[model samples]
Target: MPLTDLRQYIEGLRSLGEIQEIDVPVSLDLELGAITRRCYENGAPAPLFKAFSDHPSGFRILGAPAGTSRQPGLYLSRVALSLGLPPNSSGLEIAEAMAASLDLPPVPPVVVDDAPCFENTTTGDDVDLTRLPVPLLHHGDGGRYLNTWGCIVARTPDGSWTNWSIARMMLVDSRRMSGIVAAEQHVGMVAQAWADIGKPMPFALALGVEPAIPFVCGMPLPAHVNESDRLGAFLGRAIETVRCRSVDLEAPASAEILIEGYLHLDEKVAEGPMGEFAGYVPVEPSMRRPVYRVTAMSHRNNAILPVVVAGEPVEENHTAWGIPTSAQILHDLRASGIPVTASWIPLEAALHWLVVTVPRDWRRRTGIEDSAALCQRIGKEVFTTKAGAVIPKVIVLNDDVDPTNTRELVWAFATRCHPLMGHATFEHIPAAPLLAYLRTSEKVASATGKVVYNCLPPDEWGEALPIRASFRHGYPPEIVDRVKRRWHEYGFH
Candidate 1:
């Protein structure tokens, strides 16, 4: 069964011995972020910090909430626990499970009169955010960040659409925050709607929700779809949500901390220089972004704030966002009549690379004559989708190439792609401004280009097919079977 709450998810990790409880005194300034970063990079147990004497006892910190594990058979156990799957589930299995949820009827969230998030409340002048253990995520960051692994809940003025997204938030003062709400992002779109009506946009920053919540919230689903509804459908149950004390919105009942606020329509503050998911802290100057004014804050007893120190790959940003993004692409490609057998974003690529696979007999099945033609169709379908906003590059390969295997991806990318004629670019699409390659103009216009590197075999272009020189395909079944049977004798492990 899927874990329903953050604490339950933590217990699940504990069962697998994937969680580390640290009672040692720790500093929120940079020590916490460093330890969390190492966990993500090294696959150490997720840290649960409880000895920050400077902060309120009602506050704790959990880091690397969904990071990939170094364990042999349970590399993605944390992610699987979040999605309600077995510990040994593969990356492709998780992605396909999420994609299957797209076919089910959405189950809207269930509202409760009260939840754990309502246990304690601070309103108006009492809501001092500085009292919390907000950590400095990176050395040169603009300020201490407080929302690295949280949800930003916003709805349209007409109340027809509610978008739950993940974005960074930097603390400005006790009651104010500066965060990114790029115009192309869903939160920014809704904020613009509120600006048109001459009012501040109401938002709720929900932290420490159930493990599954952030996965759907961070997904780039269609603008018409509500993540809360899709999340309920994914688990085949309605998620419990509660009304915010000061905002006209709902937050997850499982939240460890909740902050209700209004985003100023026109006001701006310099934010950023924090390390991002792609592994690099962009060298650009601090960009001015919209400001958030906190109205109320609430939390349960001994609240635990979950955080993602997103810098390198294999972190929450890569696993959580990358898995859902692959699912969305797989759904869209199949819907568009493309024969995409599998799709994946290798962890080390940091969500920049989308690896798509087609069956060997795809040419005969779809009657697609050439590699270039198929590449065009794939690009047209993928680059136009909402999830494609952050995908800077896509790689097309045969089903035999196992999209989930980064080594195979690297092998195919290096050997199969023709330098002169293997790739195509799609320009003038919505740009994800965080990418370092984007120019100032593209960022301002919210338009950029995407590329597709055709790694499909040249056999599609009328040449005789070349044989794959791998042990699985190159050798006969009898020899492979014999080798496999004697693998222990060969001392391979």
Candidate 2:
């Protein structure tokens, strides 16, 4: 079977030298967040702080659970390991493989009578969230966040749809939390359905689930499709769940900690103004968002709390979320008959750029006459989809330029794309409000223009294409083979 839970996944990381456990006492203020941020910047091991400065005993925090690796041929090592893939899987392979799995039949969750999380349970007046030491993930954050890396489970009142999503929640008090529930988000939609009938939405906040759980939860799956089923489909087995102590929902049996609660749609609180994943320190003001009231808390002994410290590039937002998101896009594109050879959501782009590579014979395969027309079709296929809402720009290139290779992609984009005529833009589409460049109208309406840049030849140049001037492809095969074979003999290394 696949690595089905957090402990199993952590051991896999240990074998790869992708994780580190800190014995020294760490603070929940800014110290821990700073450490995780530096890990992302330097590609250091995921820091598992074993001791806390304030709430030292009975709790542990794991930061950068799926951060990118700097080691050679292991950039996405943690992500791959978490999803039960080999440590050396490439970005394209990860995305394309997951995309193909979307075609499989969904495997619904199987409810189990007991789980590790059920070892200890507290209900009614005993539920105190502050005892867990929610981290102030950044200096600019309004309050310590409790839901940065967890999954929130909400089901439609009619029991037809259930959604699992990651939304930031700040500790409001002993039993209350403030979080975002945007109307466009699935959780928000589910809450609204309950609100129409005048009842608070019951929910369960699941933290430290199996590595693959959070990644699947973060995917922009179709509105009615269950995230648990998608996860089960990917794993080729049924996922196990245990009933929540207070709520009528069932949470993943893989969760290390689970908080049962009700989402008060009428209850709003001042939230936000935090450093986010756009690679920028926040300067914005706080806004009112929904509140979550905790009713029950359940956990195992010395339960681990996983955190993202979401900011900059290559964090969970880019790794767990971005990788799976790109997989859905690749699946959508291929399902639409677009001959995409590879698709990649680059880590350094901070979730702003989606790089897609099409076969060199795209013109012949797509049966399009010109680059502009091809770009328009690509735009129509991408921007019109649900997963494309967060994407501001897409870069389309011939498969000769690998989308996962930043150097080659940058070179091809800079050299081949015509400044004015090589792109097509669509307006009045939904966009994430966090985009730094959105105009006030766009931000308010959550609508903006999305562009697709063409990095291939403008017309069917065919045999007239210029040769690539590079070490890998510029020389004849015989000469290249000889050079590679004698590279060490020449003392170049």
Candidate 3:
């Protein structure tokens, strides 16, 4: 059965020994974020904190819900279980599953009258954003962030379409919070539609919803594409949603908390300097952005807030955004007639680079011998796809080098790719401004360019490829089989 909600996903984690409950007290300040960051860096189990020193009894915090796993057989266990996949599934398997689901028709979410999200509602002056134990993620962070992994639901002016997406939000006051919404994002476009009509856009912030919902929201789908349908396609069933108290948006029925608010066109507030997926906190000044004025607040009896400490690799941003983006890139490449077998966004690269692998004999099969031309074809197609907005660097690999394996990817780039001979550059393309390499001057420019690093040898040299002298390739099959069978007897474990 599909994991219906965040609580169900938590239960699934417990069953697989992937979660660790902490009865000890933890602060809602940087202490919580610090501990969470440490756990993420170490690949430790998800931390469920029962006692928030300042918050009430029912308030709970879950850290690193989708962080990568270090288990022997379940490296992507958290990502897999969140998407209703098996615990032992590989990264490639998960990406392929999501890519295949993109072809399935999106099943719209079912609207219901009553839901746990509406169990407790606060309207009018009673609304208070400070009531929740929002965490101060990093020392350099601007303020307490209320939404990291939460999904923000918004719609077009005529209600023709709805978009669900994840963005970071910081607490401003008891009645208002502010967040960064890029103009290119779906939510930003929807908000702009409302602003063009001279009105505040109604939005609902849903936290701890069904696990698959957040994963889908992080995807960069094309404009007018309903995220609900894509999420339905992911789970192979329609999701149940409940109407917001003060907004036109609908949130996951089983969501732990919901903050209904409006994006005021005239009202702006400073929001930023938070640790981003780029692995560095931007030193730029906080800018005036849309202020989310809280109109209503709702939550379950004993609600839990899921927090994603964004920094380094393997965090929710890397796992949720990077993985699905890779799948989208793969699909786009194949559709554009590029012979891509698999693709990946290495966590260590911090979501800036993408690795795609193709069969070594692809040139022979397609009769395309000009390596530079093939590289340009791939660069133009991928850099123009939906996933291209966030990815700045592309690395093409041969089939022998698995894109999913960081070591193999490094080896291929180090040994096969020549700096001048195998590289292609595309200029005047859109680039994500948050990338640390894009300085103030480059960001101000109309467009930024990207490089396509081809880490594959020339087609003519394929047959003369040097043999890999690794244990598996160098040793006899019988000897390797015997060693594997007696691995435990040899006291290796």
Candidate 4:
């Protein structure tokens, strides 16, 4: 059966020995975030905080549900299961499934009168933001955040297309939350359109919704494609949604917490200095961000609000958004007739660097100048478009290596790539503001331009050339199988 809620997914993780419960009281002020970040950096199990000083009865917090693991491929395995695929599904399998589902017709959402999320409602004077144990995630964080892992739902002014996305929001007061909504993201674009028409943007922030919802939210779906429908397509079933009490938007029926709000065009407030995915805090004070007015709040009894501490590697930024976005880019490239064999968004790069491997046959057929130039073209195509803005660097590799393996990638760079010979550069291509180099470097021409570091040497392009053999592929298959079959007999544990 498909996993429908966060609790079920947590149970699965527990069964795999990938989760742990902490009975000790953990403060929301920096302590919880610090512990979670340490756990992620060390490839430790997920943490469940059973006690919070201010949280309502039955409410709890879960951090890093899908994170880096010491066990090989476990990170991507958890992500695959979150998307309703088998836990052991390969990256290629996940990419193909996502691409294939694009052509499948969407299953319309089912409307329901009531849901578990609406068991309690707080609005008007009764609502108090401080009552929830929202974490001050980082040491330098400006305030408590309640929407790090939550999904926001917004529709265009015409109400034709609804966009779902993940954006960080901090609780500013009892009735207000603030956060940056970049003009490039779908949510920001839709909000811009609404603001242009002098209308308040209706929105619903759903916490602990179905796992598939947030994954679909992070995807770069085509304009006019409803993300709710995409969620349905991904899960191979209809998503049940209920209308928000104070907003026109619909949120997941299984959501643990829902905040109905309206975003006015005129209101803006400072909203950052929080720990980011790039592993650094901005030097400047927080910039003015859009202000949201909460009209109603509803949640299930003992609702668990999932927190995503965005910092260096192994956080949700890498496992949840980075890996899947890379897979979708590969899918998009292949659909557009560009042959892509595999793709990886490395954890160390903080999801900004994307490395792709394509079949050598396709390279030969295209007669590309070199892998670097090919990478530049691919980067421009992706970054100049809607999907590419979030990516800054692209590395192209031959299919002989696996992009996901950092060791194999490093080896390819060390032996095959010539620094000056393999480099390719592009100008005036759009890029996200989160890149540290772009933000701090005086040499950067503009946010949109980028440079590609091609690690392969030019001499290795010939099809007839024999390259150095590696242990994985160079071993004789029969011998390898014989060793595997006799491992127990040989007394190997």
Candidate 5:
């Protein structure tokens, strides 16, 4: 069944031993952020803060709702459950399922008049953000952030398209919030269009919606495609949404909290210096960014706020956004005729390294250094053509090994990859400013942008002859069944 709400999703995590309850009083300051980061690094369960020092009754915070896990194959397991698939689904299976669903008809959203998110409404002078415990996530953070894991819904000036995306927002005051809107991002493009018209852009920030909402927001769907509709297609049912009290925008009906606001063209504030997903703080001083003025705040009684403290790997930044995004990119690339088998963005690379395994048949089809050329082409195409500029390194591997398994990838590199012959380079690809090498370096060169194609020879793409001969294709079915039936008796277990 589809996850109906945040609480149900949390319950599902609990069933899988993926959640921890913390009853002791915890500060919303840097302490909670540090604890969450440690949990992410260790692949531990999501933490439920039941006792906050200054939170309202029944107001709890959940951190890292979906993240990397200690158990093998659990990452894909959690993601599959989030998409209403079986728990034991593999990464390749998840990608194939998503790709198959792309051919299914789009499921339009069902617009309703009233919803639970509007249970309590605060507007104008009565809207006090300080009442809610907005966590000061990191030690070096400038201020409390409220929209790290939230989705911002905004419509175009012509009202032709509505964009849903995950953008970070820092609390500036009771009525104001500030965040960067990059021109390359869909939200930023829509915001700029409204700014050009000299009008405040209407926006609705949906917090703690169904787990699938944020996952869809992180996906790189084509332009003019509504993520809400894509979400419905994935769920195999229509999504329910309600109009905001103060704006024309609509939010998920099951959202725990909703903030209706406008992005003023003239209003700007100094934002940032917070630890970013790249695992480092911005070296440059905070700069002025677009300011969002909150005109109304609405929420269900005793709302549960989901917070994502972005910094290192395995956190919400990686598990909730990065890995799935890479999978989406792989789907797109393969659909566009690029031969991609599996993909992984390693957490150690700060979610920038994308390793894709390609089928050997593709290499044979395209002669002349197909692996190296394909790696360079993919890097440029994904980085410059789409929203994949956030990714930096691209590694191409053979289909024999799992791209998500670091040990397997390392083994392939050690045994097959030739340093100089396998390496490939590209230049002038627009990259995110937050890349560690780009942020800290004094002299940045073109060679900084590079991808490696660790290609195994055609003969080595398949398993060894002895191992292949031992499989079901080589063994008689009766003999194999007898061996399986007597395995426990032979003490194999």
Candidate 6:
């Protein structure tokens, strides 16, 4: 059955021994963020903090709702479970599942009169953002962030399209907050349209909705596509949504908390210096950005707020954004006639590097002997694609290296690829400013480029290649199979 709500998804995690309930009091300041960050780095089970030092009893915080799991056969458990796949499924399997939905007819969301999220409502003078247990995730962060894992629902001025996306927002006052909306993203584009019309864009921030909802919000779908429809396709059914109390936008019916507001064109405030998913804090100081003023607030009783401590590998950013983006790239490449068998973004690379693997048969079929030319072609196509805007590095590997396996990718790079001869640079490509390698000047420079590292042997090297000395490749197949079948006889666990 489809897990349509956050509460249901949390129960699913509990059933798998993937969640922990913390009765001890935790501070929403830096303490909550510290514990969550450590848990992510350790691959620990999701934690539910039931007690907060300053917050009321009717609210709770869930940290790392879909972080990596350490259990055997469940490395991508949280992600797999979100996509309605087995917990033991691989990254590629999860990505493919999400991608498959793109081909199916979109199941439009059904609007309802009521939702659990609207059970308790606050407006005007009664609204208090400080009552919520917003966490200061990193030491150098500017303020308590309330929207790290939240999805903002907004629509164009003409109401022709609606967009649901994840953007971080920081606490500014009891009823106001500031967030960054990149000009290139869909949400940003919609916000710009409203600005052009000289009005505040109506929006609703939906926190802790169904697991699948956030994944789609983070996905880079084509512009003007309704995220609700894609979300419905992901769940294999129509998603239930409720119109916002103060805005025209619709939010996931099961959201834990809904902050209805308007993003004003004239109002702006200094926003961020928070630790981003890139695993680094921006060197640039905070700047004035569009402010979101709360008009109405609603949430279920004892609402559970989800917080993602994004940094380094195996966090929500990697599992949610990295994996899905790789699948999107694969889909894009194949649609463009590139013979890419598989693609992956190593979590350790912080979502900046994308690896595309070419099938061995592709070379024979296409009669492509010039590895450099093929690399350039793939690089140009990828760099110009929407996925390429965020990914700064692309590695094209032969079938010998599995893109999903980081170790194999590294080996292929070290042994098969020549330093200068194998790498090609693609210039005049757009890249995310969050990349640490980019200087403040290069951050805005259009001339900044990306490198496509070719980790395949020259085509002239022929079909006969060096034999691997590993256990699976070095030994005889029959002997290896017999040893595998008699592991208990060999006294091994």
lDDT of 4 at 484: 84
The global C-alpha lDDT for each of the candidates, from Candidate 1 onward, is: 0.87, 0.87, 0.85, 0.78, 0.77, 0.84
Sorted on lDDT, highest at the top, how do the candidates line up? 1, 2, 3, 6, 4, 5
Instruction: Give Cα distance to truth, residue 131, candidate 3, Å.
Output: 0.7
lDDT of 6 at 402: 68
TM-score versus the correct structure, for each prediction: 0.96, 0.98, 0.96, 0.93, 0.89, 0.97
Indicate the residue-level lDDT of 187 in model 3. Answer: 82
The TM-score between candidate 4 and the true structure equals: 0.93
Model 1 Cα lDDT, one tens digit per residue, 1-493: 6677788889999999899999987888788889999998889989999877455565889999999898899899999888888889999999999998998999999989998877888999999998778988888887889998898899999999988999999999999998888877788899999999999999999999999989998788988699999998899899988998898998888888999999995898888879998788878889888899999998888888998988878898888899999999998888888888998988888888899898877777778888888888888888887888888889998887888888877888899898877577888977577766778898778788888898877854553456779998899999999999999999987
TM-score: model 3 vs. ground truth: 0.96
Runs of candidate 5 exceeding 4 Å displacement: 367-370, 440-454, 458-493
lDDT for predicted candidate 1 compared with the true structure: 0.87
Q: Candidate 2's residue-wise lDDT over 1-493, tens digit each? A: 5888888888888889988999999888999999999998899999998898877588888889999888998888998888888899988888877898899999999999989998888898998887786888888889889888888999999999989999888898989998778899899999999999999999999999988888898898988999999889998888899888898999888998899989998988898877777876567788888889999998889899998888778798998878888999999988888888877788788788998887767767878777888888888988877788889999988888877778988899899888888698898988888877887788889999899998877674862457899988799999999999999999999
> Which residues of candidate 3, in runs, are more than 4 Å off?
365-367, 444-446, 462-464, 475-482, 486-491
Off by over 4 Å in 1: 53-56, 459-465, 490-493
Rate residue 129 of model 5 by lDDT. 75
Model 1 TM-score is 0.96
Shift in Å, residue 114, candidate 4? 1.2
Error of 2 at 55 (Å): 2.2
- The TM-score leader among the candidates is 2
